[model samples]
Target: MVAEKDANAAKEILQQFEAARTQVGELVTAAEKNNQHFDQLIAADNAAGHAIINQAIMALVAQTGSIERAAGIIGIDNLNPDTADHEF
Candidate 1:
């Protein structure tokens, strides 16, 4: 009778382990989806920031009447050419 009880307990433990594994898989899937959505949001925010910077730079250029002068005033002209090219 004790052996039979032990077998039953082992079966119960196996069931619980399966259930926990399934829950962990579901959590991982949800986390991956959340990360994908967060990445998209970050990309959109970066694009918006770039757009705002471009607009401001254009406005400055209009006021200054020369892109070079505008860049000089904003210190963009002082940046390393390679770094400035990559950033813009």
Candidate 2:
């Protein structure tokens, strides 16, 4: 009876993990889509949009006290000096 209970518990845990994994996968897809849209918006030749985005990034950097940390929080990568010259 104890062995059966253990096996049942393991199966329940596995089912919950699978459900969580599916939910995470859906969230990742949504985030990716949103990121793509943001990239497109930033790529456009809109000075106001650029300024707003830069301001938001600067605010995050100021609040976090590190540009890298701000970028990480916003799911951005490769925020090096060369690429971020215009951003600051």
Question: 1-88, model 2: which lDDT tens digit per residue?
Answer: 2224455544544554455555444434534754534455466785644654555555444433343443454567776544344543
Worst 10 residues of 2 by lDDT: 61-70
Give TM per candidate: 0.31, 0.32
For candidate 1, the per-residue lDDT at 19 reads 52
Best by TM-score: 2
Global CA lDDT computed for model 1: 0.44
The runs of at least 3 residues in candidate 1 whose Cα sits more than 4 Å from the true structure, single-residue gaps closed, are 1-5, 33-88
Model 2 accuracy (lDDT, Cα)? 0.49
- RMSD after Cα superposition, model 2: 14.6
